[model samples]
Target chain A: MAFLTADDIALLNEPQLAHVATIEADGTPHVTPVWVDTDGEHVIFNTAKGRVKHRNLERNPVVAISVSDRANDYRTLWIKGTVEMTTEGADEHIDRMAKKYLDKDTYPFRKPGEERVIVKVTPTQRLSQG
Target chain B: MAFLTADDIALLNEPQLAHVATIEADGTPHVTPVWVDTDGEHVIFNTAKGRVKHRNLERNPVVAISVSDRANDYRTLWIKGTVEMTTEGADEHIDRMAKKYLDKDTYPFRKPGEERVIVKVTPTQRLSQG
Candidate 1:
């Protein structure tokens, strides 16, 4: 698998929203807007286990995410990757993302019966534009 | 396939950037930012035949697109659909979309030795949020 460059990490660090697409078992697609993060390599997002995106990822790890610069829509990053999902520390991960995205100390949208999972995607290819 | 509502058309009519994801023959995803349009039912975008996105759509039409309101990032629309690609009138369609997104009289990005295609996506399901 390929890896993201420093420039790609810079784009991911921005406050722009990212859209992720996961293919279904039947080859259809399920896409959603997500708060995206990265550790300068792996792109990450957290979602509940019951969410459709989580279910799709469980069946097929292949995923793609695209995000444009909030200030300049022409500057964008597109990542093609496979995911590794883990439940450990998912709550903490969401809290960190909430702080980055919503200025909240904790994720305020948690449901009573939901279980969060953190998906870490290792890039196989990255398309970065200015 | 499902039909888009008037509200959905309104969203597509806005001058927001849209990202489309198409699954490659090997199931890896290819995502790109596009200028989007609609005829109150089908979402549309134009791409050159040599573009990676157009190649992916040719073999597997199942695609997902997400676009957020440029003015307010929270408002978004995610559409899952199958595409109908045609070359007829594609040049004109690109001019229209260029005018909307770039305020250009014609598509300023067309290249030599390229053939443009118009992709009309009929939504199978849509996820809209404000």
Candidate 2:
């Protein structure tokens, strides 16, 4: 497994959006933006249980994420990884993500009856450019 | 096939970077940032021969692209498409992309012995959010 570099950790600590790609049942790709974080070992993001990405990852764990420096597009972190998802601590995780991305004490867009899931991606391949 | 909306076209016209995902032979995803464009009917981008993206697209046309407004991360476009690659006009195309992205008359990163390829993606699905 590939390990996150100091630069990668620094980028993840910034308030930047990450574009995540997952494979559909038909072998096509699905991608969307998400608030991103890193535990210094795995890349983490939060999603609702019924989201397209959650469904896709449930079937196929393989995923790719691209995060670029908002100020410098050339500085980017591209990670190909497999995800381990859980509901454990997902509520607090989203609140932490909200603090980073929205500067809110809690996620402002939480839907009623929605079940939050935290996805931890263990990088198998990591590439960066600047 | 899905068509680009005026908003999608406008987003493409901006100097935003796009994260493109292609499937590797191992069924894993590879993603990176690229200079993005559109020809009204298709999403377009440029790359050189022997690049991982070029090789991946040559093997599997299925692709996904995500482009978020630099100023507002919430404004984003996510597209799943099939690519049609060509060497024809690729040189001129990169120059145009250079003009849009780098404000240069020509692509300044051209390398000796590198063959540029133009990739046009016919979107099968387009999703947007703000």
Q: Which candidate has the highest TM-score of all?
A: 2
Q: In model 2, where do residues sit more than 4 Å from their true spots?
A: A128-130, B128-130
Instruction: Provide per-model DockQ scores.
Output: 0.50, 0.55
Number of clashing residue pairs, candidate 1: 0
Interface RMSD, candidates in the order listed: 3.2, 2.8
Clash pairs, candidate 2, are none
Error of 2 at B52 (Å): 1.2
**Candidate 2 docking quality: incorrect, acceptable, medium or high:** medium
For residue A129, give model 2's deviation from the true position in Å. Answer: 8.3
Give the lDDT of residue A64 in candidate 2: 90
- lDDT against the true structure, per candidate, is 0.82, 0.87
